[model samples]
Target: MSGFSSFWASQNKVFRISIILLLLASITYGQGNRKPFAIEGKLNLTSWDIDQNPIELNGDWFFYWNQILTPQDGLLSFNQENKNIKSFPGLWTDYEGDTSYPSFGFASYLLIIEGLEKDKEYALKVPDMYCSYQLWVGSKLVASNGKIGRDAESYEPEWRPVTVNFVAERETESILLNISNFDHSKGGIKNSIVLGPVEHLASQKTNEVAANLIRIIGIALISIISLAGFFLYSKKLFTYFSIFSILWSVRGIFSNMYLIYSWIPDFNWTLGTKIEYLTIYTSVLVGYHIFHNLFPNHSNKIISWASIFINSTFIIITLVSPAVMFTELLNIYFGLMGLLLAYILINVIQAYIYDEKGAGYLAVAITLIIILFFYDMLSYYKFLPYNPYITSIGYVILYGLLGYTLRYNQLHKSKDTTFKFS
Candidate 1:
């Protein structure tokens, strides 16, 4: 266990990156002008009605591969790419072209949106984008997010949504966006972008920030609760569960991309991600340890050692690999989860059938967890739209059940001695 703790301590170097992905919406085509290779999406400004809803900026935009430079970096390169266009709200890696997939470097997207009211305030909500990006409306640079490195060694992914508000200086605007992503497999705007009134954008930002704060506070409370149990019980199950709770609380802190990026704007998202995944893996390790302790007969030393070995190897691989490769192994994590749940289910049922104290609550808890795990797995595979962090919720219940079981066992032993002596 000491060695295991030391291994986790060594993973302090890991960081993570990802940003708030705005929901995808449909686009309505309207009158707009276009240039060769530039997307001419309709940025309708006719309606100021609060109920009018936002307009989705969709169409093919200029796409450059493995090159993140200033707009003037290529005096001749910009003009020559008249036919090179990639659709908006899609990754360049998925775009069909002469260029190969997974182009690992810098890229730029150029969109020319014409027909806008002069001197009117407008806001463009950037969707969850991979790696980093810089937005230039006309000749003025409006915003930049995360660290944009020229190459792999310099590249660290940190994701955050940014709202760019600008007054229409002219009736026509050419938006030049320089983006770079070496973190994930496909990189670009994965979510739909909204463009509309500045007020609406501000309201949206406020809601996002509020949600993040609430989530962090709630997770912090859970950690505190579990910590109290750990200290009061001084049992292995309670200690492991406490560690798991704290890890999840840490995950919640970094879960909201927008707030985190705001606080640590320049901090490496990759490092954050490493910490995130490390917590996840570590939780599972300690989780199995708790199970093995509670049901020692069902899981022996061999089973214990195997679980440790497998997770330890995965953690090492995760620390060394890029985000793209690591994501591919997520299914494996799911599979291991399924195995653990099956084992726990069997043992929990056996305990219940034998009339063990607190086994009933433990049974109910594990059953609910299995159901939540199923739903979360579906959400993970895009089978469901709701991204329920059920694991966190499930663990909270499990921790409480274990606490009850520990106390119940102690009372059961005390009652037996009293009966025998009488």
Candidate 2:
């Protein structure tokens, strides 16, 4: 224990510094870095250059709760008394205005952009909303995702991030969106809708797609390598890690950019969502097994079995139930995962205390994973501001450390064998 204490004390500063740097990088990356935002459905960007900085169409937009208005209806046709202002990049459930808004409902969002050069080629980057949405630019229906309906039966949920290009016919433009949600727990535009020059938006979308592809490819490569390692070496650790990597890769396809749907346009939404949730639940389960295998003496058998039971139950629930029913279990699952990680960390510490091979590296990786996990959880619940692609950053760092640890262990084992023979 004294040895462990001294070792941790010596490395504490370095670890904290590394984590802080990572956190800062994650917070700052891909944040648009624009201060200008919409106010009461109007954004003035006369001075701003769209080519230089694509603005996130965030902030207060003219929200018509429970009313799905169209460009044909005219923005002014809505009841003045029912007019409400709601902030974007957030769910309607968070709205606290004239009337309380439920998670599942239909609404219209209107944002008027002023001070644009007439007839200039510009683009709007529309992210995947809660379920389905239709966008209109000055009475022209430019883009839509799935079919937006007032009720569940008529609603068809689809997730496809789109970049729509248009020529600014006038100096001011009215952007109207009719969005509906009945399939998911959260509704409304939760992600930023970006507005910028056509070329810039296209470049940005290309870069984003490229990054997501790289991440998915990297994870898939790890899984393949781990699987090969398992087959060659017949190690349980390799098998578990391979499963973890594979699950995350599938999750990456469904999440972030929803690349799978892009590749297969007719992919089922509910199935994709189910796979996403299953991957998360199973990845943690596999992660626990990895830790248990590393330091079996430190792992409690009863606790391990209990965890298995709980994760199995969650997996079963996800498979059998509707998306709405299974999605609500995420908060509870996050709490359980926190506890599970704590236990795993304690075992890793024990392994480190005994001077187990590669334990130090494992400890560092797990610590970072826990930090990122909490950050993601808080961001998901809106307790903290969310950062796009932050999880991918965390995964890159975590997997790098894990890969190094694996290599270190293998090298040391070979050396030990050679020494024994000598």
Candidate 3:
């Protein structure tokens, strides 16, 4: 076999390598020579060119708060000399240094990038905002995610990355963002913003959206496989895991929700936010069942059932209530999460103390989860500088642990059965 394999490898290796290299070169050359679909701007936009090849638009900008102004406001009787926010990656949260920060109200940012070609095509690439915003390019409203409201029940969170395409109608233009936040723990922009040729940003976003879809679909597959686990092994934990993963994955659909919005143009984003929290609330309920089944001896069945009942009630209420009401319930849900986590930790500790089989591994995983959850929560609260992808990492750890536990239990049960039969 080795002699034949050696001959086969030697026979076509050079030819295969040559073909691959030729194809790669051809592809590279073709892409290099292709003309950009949108009009090209000079390299390096000194402002909000935050990060992009052939440049991004990021830098210092003028900012003001306490009002949700329109492009017309900036045009008619509006002062361009409003106090500078004095940041490259501008966010109203930066102003939180002052105790009087208007975190829950409206703020406007203004920047003008020049050296663009007249009548050429361009698009501003906007990342997720804390709550809502309206993007304006020289008095033209180009894009907005959710309706921006100035106060409590009026504010909503709808964050889907957008590429607002337009003709570079003039060489110099006003890039105005009327941003408001009342949903996130920390309100306002926290990342670099960009503006450039439509094709440059659009192509980059196409790749990003493709990745997001793949992630959602992968989780979707996991949910189906988990559901099938019940029939294969006849364990109730599989059912709980199925629901939990499905709920979490369904919530993730909002991240790439533009796909749905594209098909249903009139679809309101507030509905998406409601459904997001709905899934979140329900997922926590099912998560309790997972623990209840996994550690039936050490878990408190009454508390688990009560959690499910309460969460279910709220979810029903969310379905009927206005989206604003749903937003109001978030703090309560988080408080419940704290209580649930505390209760589960107590149960896990008891399981570990009693020397329950496999409890050690679960304890370790849960401990890591608690740490990461707190870190991520702190980051969310503006108490930390790190914006690491802790949630997804924590989920991966959880799913991996749950999968291993199921497999271990199955294997142990099968061995015991074989021994008894023998």
In order, what is each prediction's RMSD in angstroms?
13.5, 7.1, 12.1
| Candidate rank order under lDDT | 2, 3, 1
Top lDDT: which candidate number?
A: 2
Task: Name the top TM-score candidate.
Answer: 2
lDDT digits (tens) for residues 200-286 of candidate 3: 778767765665565566566777888887788776566767787777777766654355555454566667767777888878877
- What ranges in model 2 sit over 4 Å off? 1-34, 78-82, 367-397, 403-422
- Model 2 whole-model lDDT (C-alpha atoms): 0.79
Query: For model 3, what is the error of residue 131's alpha carbon versus the real structure, in angstroms, after optimal superposition?
Result: 6.8
Q: Is candidate 1 or candidate 3 better by TM-score?
A: 1
395 in model 1: Cα distance from truth in Å?
Answer: 9.1
Better of 1 and 2 by lDDT: 2
User: What tens-digit string does per-residue lDDT give for candidate 1 at 308-332?
Assistant: 8988987897899977777568778
Kindly provide the TM-score of model 2 when superposed on the true structure, using C-alpha atoms.
Answer: 0.83
Using Cα atoms with residue i matched to residue i, what is each candidate's TM-score against the true structure? 0.67, 0.83, 0.63
What's each prediction's clash count? 15, 0, 7
lDDT of 2 at 422: 9
Candidate 3 — which residues are off by over 4 angstroms? Answer: 1-72, 77-109, 112-123, 128-133, 146-159, 165-172, 178-192, 195-204, 255-259, 353-355, 364-397, 410-422
Clashing pairs in model 2, backbone N/Cα/C closer than 3 A: none
